[model samples]
Target: MDNTIFAQSIARIRSLETKMIDKAKIEAMVESRDFNDCLRFLQDTQYGSYITASNYEEGLKSATIDIYKEMYKICPLREVVDILALRYDSHNIKSLIKGKLAGIDTLYLTVDAGTIPVDRLNIMVKEENFRDMPKTLRYYVEKAFENYKNSQDPQDIDITIDKGIYEYMLEIAESSKMEYLLDIVKLMIDTINIKSFIRINIQERGRDFMQKVLLPKGNLDKDLFLNNITDSLESFANKIMHTDYFKWVKEGLGEYIKKGDLGSIEKYGDNYIIDYLKKAKLVSFGPDPIIAYILARENEIRAIRIILTGKRNDVSPDIIRERLRDVYV
Candidate 1:
């Protein structure tokens, strides 16, 4: 985890980052006159070949898969890549399961960035056979099915799979024995829990609902959320001031309470993680830069989708801007 094993992969990723979608490019896309104009903005970057006026979604998914393929080839430790790919795998599991139960197409929501190929995963979910899937993911897939059967709730599929995603992430971090990876995973869990907490309160759900949604073993204690079930979001934000999330939670709550902007909380959380990942630039050689590059690409893909969707729907630039996540520098 702390060696020059990742030197080659980091070098390739460093060069790629330069060609990445920058802030100026993002602004051009956002301020574009229409959806076609936004497509023009991406045409000059790495996304040029894959994107078009009508099928930006396909391009985005392709770009995501291409990066994972490149990283898998260059990265010395495949597990490092697996840690990032696991998120996509979990996403596919959730989408496919829900789609199967509802008897509809959810392929558009699936990304090819997972460790398993998209076609194979779709088939696996269709046939209800995951024996060939990754062990951690397979177990979660089975559990999700059971949870859904018991509750007859499609939301159970999402929640169970979401929990599984982080569980597998934490396991990867712990097994890798990298303090950096472990800490990032913990912060992410804390962030997810916080978002869930906010959503339940915003929806006026009960503490019993909170108990079912919260994940296990983040840096923050579960009681911090359970005990604060009755407090306002503002009060809860004030309480977490001494924790690592003090700054964003405080600032984000302002927009949330005053304007009912839930996106602010999410934007601040993404910014927080990107700011944390910025430190990896100082590490001459390690897995840090590799993971940082992966997430940076993910952030870039999300921004592209946001701007294009906003353009298509004629949404305001200011409102769209609020929905965007922080760019990796």
Candidate 2:
């Protein structure tokens, strides 16, 4: 890829960065008196146009779709955007596959922002057609279907497709030859593996489950996890304490031991990734800024959703704030 190709796109992204929702704006939404108050706060920001729609969920969805649409239009390299958007494709596939198994319409759960169109994906899933999807994805879809057929468990579908998605991401990152992008994907894999390991341990699942669900290509090796899958949570945390995730894992383990909240791990992991992505701010050109901006915007949207949903449900602002992930801006 030509680094020069991203110069203009980076400039556009820099201008767009000014409009991202900052910490204070997110706080304002969090402190809003009620759901309507939260909605009103959103109306003054870049999300104003979308928030005016009848349903806040639909409005958020529209905003997300619009951001990807903008990214596709402005980015010179489509692959960069595709790397980030690949998760949505995996998500759509999971939803559709589960929906197919359960005899429900999963279209509502699908997002249109992925590299593949939701309708086409839905058609492919319905007809059991893998010819059009990427080979890695197609292979996983077939495998996931076969697993689900034998086990008749929806969780198998998620595990199979998720593993496939990260495998594809690793391929893209390697092929793109961008160290920054590869690092991001590796960080994501490590975080996911850590989270899954904790959950499986807590649930008292066996090594068989771990071997099947745990993804490869992360910073930690498959053997490392396999050897430690049966270890106690504290022992497991200690094992990984030498790695970059030491601080977060330590804190999350503390929370789990004290308050019994696994969410602490997830929260810390999310913020850790965001902090890692913040390094892209130092780059004045290339796809780093654009990728970072997209991630930041997506995180911003998630924070807003959490706040809005909390306000709607009469959840305490403190709880909402605790649940809020760090913003990129």
Candidate 3:
């Protein structure tokens, strides 16, 4: 893909960035007295027009779909868009496959923001016909089905499909020949690996489970994790302290040691990735800004959902604030 191809799209994304929910706005939403107050706050932003008191959830979903749809329309590089959107495809696949195995209707859970339409993906999964699907996706669906047949564990479907999505994403990034995007993908893969290592270690799961779930194409060596699977979390953190993830690992380890909450690790990892992506803001004409904008918008939506849900449940504002990840803005 030509770097110049995204010049116009990046400009548009820069304009759209002004409409994104900023830190102050998110703080206000967090401090909002009730769910209605939160909805009213959203109504005052880019998302305001899409949201209604009676259907905030649907409104948020609509806004998400609209953002992706707009990106598809504005960006000349569909491959870049597809690479980001493929995660949604993998998510829909997991929902559909799990629904099928359990005899449940999960159509509502599927999002249409993927490269392929939700209905078509549902059909492909149902008929086991993936001729038109991407090779990685096709492989994942087939392998997940076979795994499910043998183990009858729904989690097998999720694990298999997730690995496939990352593998496919890395392939797309490499094929695009964009080192920036490739670095971002590798960072994400490494983050996932780190988080998984922390979780699986806490669960005391062995190497087999680690081998099954650990994805390839990450910046971290798989053997580093394999070798340290039996070590203490502090020891594991010490090993990776020489890498880019040292700060986050240190903080997350502190949180884990203090509260036994793995969420702290996941949160730190997510914030670290977002912070890394924020570097794209310095680039003037490239796909990096476009990708950064998309991620920012997604993070904004996630923060809003957390605030609204917390407000609705009468959860404390301090608690919501604590759970909130760093905003891309």
- Compare the candidates by TM-score and give the number of the best one: 3
lDDT, candidate 3, 228-308, per-residue tens: 888898898889878989999899888878987788998898899789888988887778887888888888888888888
Global CA lDDT computed for model 2: 0.88
**Better lDDT candidate (2, 3):** 2
Superposed model 3: Cα runs more than 4 Å off = none
Give the TM-scores of the predictions, in the order they appear.
0.95, 0.96, 0.97
lDDT of candidate 1 over 209-253, digit per residue (tens): 998899988999999999998789888988898998989888778
Q: Per-residue alpha-carbon lDDT of model 2 for 1-329, expressed as tens digits? A: 56788888888888999998899988988988998888888877898888753587888888898989999999877878888899999899999998988899989998888989999999999999989888999999999999999999888999999999999989998998878788888889999989888888888897888898888988898877778888888888788778999888888888778878889889888888889889888887678888889889989888988998899899999999999999888
lDDT of the candidates, in the order given: 0.86, 0.88, 0.87
TM-score, cand. 2: 0.96
The ten-residue window of minimal lDDT in model 3 covers 48-57
Clashes of each: 0, 0, 1
Which portions of model 1 show Cα errors greater than 4 Å?
Answer: none
